[model samples]
Target chain A: MSTVQITRLSMPKWGLSMTEGTVVQWLVEEGTILEQGDEVIEVESEKINNAVESPAPGVLRRQVAKEGDVVPVGGLLGVIADAEVPDSEIDAFVEEFEATFVPEEEEAAGPEPEKVEIGGKSIQYLKMGESDATPLVLIHGFGGDINIWVFNQETLSTERPVYALDLPGHGGSVKDVGSGDLDSFAGIVAGFLDAMGIEKAHLAGHSMGGAVAAAIAIQHPERVASVTLIASAGLGEEINSDYIEGFIAANRRREMKRVLGTLFANPDLVTRQLVNDVLAYKRLDGVDEALRAVADSLFPDGKQANVLDISRIQAPVLVIWGDKDEVVPASHAQNASSGAKVETIENAGHSVQMEAAGKVNRLISGFLDEAES
Target chain B: MARRITFMQAINEALAQEMERDETVVVFGEDNAGGAGAPGEDDAWGGVMGVTKGLYGKYPGRVLDTPISESAFVGAAAGAAASGLRPVAELMFVDFFGVCMDQIYNQAAKFRYMFGGKAVTPMVIRTMFGAGIRAAAQHSQSLYPIFTHIPGLKVVVPSNPYDAKGLMIASIRDDDPVIFFENKVLYSVEGDVPEESYEIPLGEAEYVREGDDVTIVAIGRMVSMAEQAADALEDEGVECEIVDPRTTSPLDEEAIYESVENTGRLVVVDESNPRCSLASDIAALVAQNCFDHLKAAPRMVTAPHTPPPFSPALEDLYVPDPERVAAAVRETLGTSDRARA
Candidate 1:
């Protein structure tokens, strides 16, 4: 609606719980031209640190927030406009935006994660941005919770409803994963959709949850619109058993930190709070037994017990993996059917969804848009 | 969602949760159930600081109010623990431990070894310690180092609410007799604690802050002081890594050793007197094991070797503060303001 295009690249609200973020440093300076998805600034919340990307193609006109300054969610970080835009106009724009901007209140109205009993198992999920359009379902890997989508869920839910869930034996869900195999988990997720009254959804899963999504598409083809797998299992025969065994045996924060380091290419991403959180989860009652059962059933004898046929999938499929993935090989993406699309992100590991969320979200968004059309 | 509660509330929650899980667990102290049958308010004081306040109403018969004889009740706790009840007896003040030392150091500690490993004294003696309340010489003392000297006894001194809950649960479930020390000053200190029961394994140290310039190993309430020092030190272009050894008996020597070796400098901050305290213990550990890695003599900041004073000003000066700890850090780094002058 404006004759002069101006974009406010404010602080991104990564998850439901994040109220503010401190600007660590700016990667790109003002007056530099930026592409749609270039890394512009590094911001850190209490949970983790990540770089904020550009919203659109423009010349960064002014850096509004200084490094080390704490800014509330949606507060302005920098202004983006064309080079031909006058300085007076840009200043007016910045002044007008800050004058009208109000950070969110204490999150009383923000979305919250809810629990649903699926086949007598409590599964916690966060639902965002409701619409009649085909909903998108997010599935976390083994030993993960609904918080894994701290970077993906909110952005993907802008148009269609997105649901991120904690599988059995993880997060706030019941720490009872009966049999803890691919098909049992698949059935639980299928029942979860039924409990939520979601008829069909575009399913996306990471790591162990990927196998669950693929199994759903294979067994209950009617409930799946499309399938997206990120460094997924069920298509491959090999998994890093050391990481599996180490995760179950690491009861202390120091050992847990070393174990979580293998998940990311940049081990520095593994913060003290992350390790403490994982340790807290593992220390809960019955969680140790649940993880053991899941590991024994899923990765028996240091190898995947059941490798599904990705060829049997009826829904459109998109396979994404980090080229540097150490836990599960990226070469497994080669197993995708000719009809499916595959992508491998460079310099990311098994946790490609979290390490490179912006790129993964863009890829999934583009794939889902094409599939829906 | 993260819910912030006080350290006292955390300990109470841990007791409630463990009692709910294991029916054999029982709680008794001088005023834990202030007045049981002959009182207007059933759950009166909770304890001296209300740490066990409401448990009597929930589990009436289980929570008992003991007579003010520490030796008698403590010996009874040891007997109850050996006879099958996992009793958590509160020693009102650690200063009273002299009367119950034989029961703790001899009878309860040697059971498993003396009984050919067949017997276990699963007991926890929760007591209050520290000098900030101006309780004078008799009531205020940092005596955890004394318990750490005894065998077959686990010593836990938690610094915050989260650790308070986890360490309390762990101490309750431990097979050995555990001496759980709570600082009266930290009763109202708040931190995020989960509602569910969890355990932080004994002998593991928490890295409160990770830095490369120096290592500060602070015990109990000194952990927060070291954190404050680290923050001020950070502004001066010095990064200090802080290590909180949650348990003094089963010390994580490896963590302390590795941290000191990495930074090549150490400062041990303990609220106890310097002689044979955790500060000296850790300093000696690093000196013996990490000698080749040392860049300077390890400095220690501790209270003077004297009975705590009743004068408010002297008592305030008696306890270690952030400025003293930061000064010790600067002394080790050779960046002291005096050195600059």
Candidate 2:
């Protein structure tokens, strides 16, 4: 094999169902050095408008997918290499790559999320990177599922196995939220870990998921090696109750679109796909009741019903918050114990993992690595 | 452009387009994938009625075929939706809702309100309804009113292929739990449906035909009857406005009120039994909201309060037809009054 350092800027899959996306703009021109995680190109999928950061540190050699070009998932979008790489080789590589790239059969064959029976309910989960290393289980907050980790899961899984779960009453997991409480959800998570045969895991949660993770750390400490909280609830006394209530009550497109806007700092992140997705979920049979129970039991008003003391957490804790989080207040981070290495991300909101995946991933990976060491 | 496709095809196309546009949209029901088991023709039956045909081949695992357990799969669809998936569960027939209504009425409906407005359960339950096809009582019934009675649920009864495709697409994309009732008899009735994905906002009424003499608001299959009545009425010099309220839960009260406001005479046509049917509902709405707009008391043309007869002649008579609809409109605008004056 010829030793040639190459950067594969393939079409980015922002979410599970995004088979194609349009290149919105390129922030950096060709022939520029890009450190890993550096923003290079911004892309717009049906569900989100996200910036594709450099996966590896290298020179951005060529701009393959120009602005406004819609490319299929796995399609070659660009290339990166050291300045020493021959121009002729780069040209030949691009030609060969384009010639051989076959858009997978139009038969809808893509990543298949699996559902396993955990605690007498169907648990939907997406697992990536088949490493024997301790798996990282991502649990999303209220009204969220594995799709919320679409950006972070694939990136973080490169070093170790990563699994994103749709907690009960969320995602493809069971809708029967037995108690519709944090403890009930924690039990379900622990049961899922047991069913997956995972002895220990780095648990990461967003919003209400943070409380679920905290509950797990307190009750089933042995199963959790570390914890990462992103814009989590249960940390503060204040939450945007209006947003929650509006999200639950808004059934029409205009109403739902307006309600979902409150989750992000930019508000633009609540794309049409996101609204449609949330609406589709809301139409399911028992989902509404389960959601209502969770909402009433967890956060009755603007205040969180289940607040766990992070200082009592046995595992190493890493609390990540968006400085401008609108749904969950950013000041909640101050309540976290000083022992917990808390990082408040700027220009991010409640969905820090999606808004600033690169920064959040590095923080998560660094914390996970430290725990393993 | 409008093209002819089976009712099943219309539902399938609606689902396929919606899923393509929205990744969170998913489809699951009994035998939705067809040949999940057995040796011959792995993709055996797309569905019992084959309405979901070809979708399995196109969407693969997303078009899930569940066990005959409606409660389990329906509840699972609801559960999956609460978590992340925007699942569309097929009940096969509205009559089978008895086995799994708790998921729809209690669970899916209550999510938004009971959650203190923190939960959004965007889901759709599509089922075949109405009398015809010799499917008998168990398979045939107009149950939209039952669903419409529920505050949280949005009940949809598409009148034709165009409405079927657009309304089904809208139901899939809608944020609330919508009971999309497809008339089994009208599935084969072809009409224009746009290939590109578009949503016809729920609770909006469609003016099938404009008229000056009398306003005839119809539901589901009866809208076609009313349209035919309007065509016949046009030849007789009596114009009639035909309105189709695609959804009943988010009832187009404004549409009914507006038509009444304009025509000053109303005739509501419904295929369901007269008592407590969409006809009565519309009449009550007009009386309560647009009472001053009426030139005469509103008239309701509907099937008598009785189980649909199996005899073709009786069944045909039992359902509201163009003649009955035209007569109701004529009564609302009596030519004798003009002749006498």
Candidate 3:
């Protein structure tokens, strides 16, 4: 039999603040065939429920972690090898990996987010992977920051550079949102790219960010090569004013949890950590006024006031939305003009990027790839 | 900056400096913005007592005035804290804790331990405590011991303007939930406070007056009385050691033990009722912890176990005074082992 080498399968870090996770169950038994991105195990953390995906395709020759075992990030959970590898070597390798493996100190420190000042305001943005490919800038919705892309950024960045930023009035960015309009928000995004010295790149945005990306392509055409909108705004007049109003008005946990629940098809995705994130933003000194200003000025009566003129957008636009989106109403998908390609994801909600990340990623990747070709 | 300012001004300065230093610090309470929803000038009150006066204009939107609803806003502050906001919620009076105690004791205090140690509720509840303002029983009370009883809550009672300012700033930055008590009577009393932002450790106690004759433990407003009693005893050559436990929950029991060990005599001055009061608690702690060091039985001078009287003369008698505290110290000093029996 031909000898086969296998890499030790280490525990994966799913989100930004996940330090350690409990291995709830292993999906595949020992010596099972495993494909790249296959769900090897289910790990539960303080943040969210995530299925650990296999990084490489191989036969799962050994399981190092048992069910209901608590392990730190980077601890070996399993081993993958070609079927040709002898069983004796696999058994010896499992013992050695467990006995000698030491979890990385950096993993224990958790995912560290970085910040840079742009336009005199501190902008927090997380960069993943070291690919020479042009960086893809990910902008979150009205009340989100860089952490929303925690699920996709690291995985997608393996193929190219990826960056997610906190816009003004959100996350670590300056709490003051001047005028709290899309134009100002788009200007800040463009200014941020300019400050970072990026001339052209793919832009991906969620909800309100979708409209901002659309506006960016229309106004600063040279800076954006392509645009991807996830449950984006500016597509139509139909939006859940209740979600917007509830988000702005929610100051307590129970209330914020209910409002955030409207963003996802699986209301369970609106976890305590998620509500805590929004509360943290709302509690900041100027964040409440900033949010209120944006809500009043942009979506005063539950309708988006700023709509991008699709005709002016020069870049290729790919619009993705959840068929069951309660936030921006699935009806808005009909508003996309002739040129833009639209895909309504079934069994998803307002947070299409989060609920259907793989499909959304494939759609965005294909659109950008065609644009590059 | 070193000159005297009212306790309320000192508190205001501490809050203003903290808000300036950290963008996360915010101040909100009923009438915190003064004229909320009113036709006259905005921020007319700065607070009900004008302690937060001028902050609304200085840090617009940061200092907020909420509706009379305490639970909603106080719980909001706790929720905000768990997320990322370090909010300072004012309950107006500690007596009003009835309206928002769940937010403070249950939510803010337990987030750390109950969340599997993943959450940090960095919040501060600032409220007026103690009596002598003639605000009646409903608006006046020293409930620090009740808050101190909660495991995760840090109860802070600053005895003077200096401790009030420093401890308020410290409470704002502390990772655990802190209940900061401001004696209403001391708010108008002047003292020297630093202009810069600084923090005094939460669990530390300060020895105001050092003497070996007797160890007097006081809290909040009672510290001043103990000091006065110590001063009056100086002429008679009966030197008294005064120890102020700035925080009751993270009680500086070691400090009390050490003072008792040195003085071999103890007298506790408390403004609260004599039973189950902080004074009695401290007296019990010293009696149990330093039984061998005692020259006489521990003495506690406190108000009667009853609601604070409404009349000025009766109220004055109801609150523990310096003369009474001095008399307790003298009684404890005069009694020998045979005399005590």
In model 1, the runs with Cα more than 4 Å from the true position are: A1-11, A17-34, A40-45, A58-109, B1-4, B31-37, B40-46, B54-65, B79-85, B110-119, B209-216, B225-242, B254-267, B283-299, B322-341
**Per-model TM-score (chain A alone):** 0.97, 0.92, 0.86
User: Candidate 3, residues A9-118: lDDT per residue as tens digits?
Assistant: 77776676676776778988887888876778877666555567676889988778887566787888888888888888888888787788776664454346677777
Candidate 1 docking category?
medium
Candidate 2 iRMS, in Å?
A: 10.0
Residues B1-341 of candidate 1 have per-residue lDDT tens digits of: 34899999999999999999999999998988875453645637778778999898888789898888888999999999999999999999999999989999989998988999999999999999999998999998999999999888999999999999999999999988999999999999999987778888888888887777789999999999999999998788777899999999899998898898889889999999989999999999999999998878899999999999999999999999999999998888884422222
Deviation of model 1 at B318, angstroms:
2.9
Q: What ranking of all candidate models by lDDT puts the best one first?
A: 1, 2, 3
lDDT of 3 by residue, B59-149 (tens): 8779888888899999989998999989998888888888888888888899999999999999888888777878778877777778877
Evaluated on chain B only, what are the TM-scores of all the candidate structures, in order?
0.96, 0.93, 0.95
lDDT of each: 0.90, 0.82, 0.81
Q: Which prediction has the highest DockQ against the true structure?
A: 1
* DockQ of each two-chain model: 0.55, 0.05, 0.03
Better of 1 and 3 by lDDT: 1
Interface RMSD per candidate (angstroms): 2.0, 10.0, 12.8
lDDT of 2 by residue, A85-136 (tens): 9888889889999889987554365457888988678888888888889899
**lDDT, candidate 1, residue A247?**
93
TM-score of each: 0.86, 0.58, 0.56
Tell me how far the alpha carbon of residue A132 in candidate 2 is from the true structure, in angstroms, after superposition. 1.5
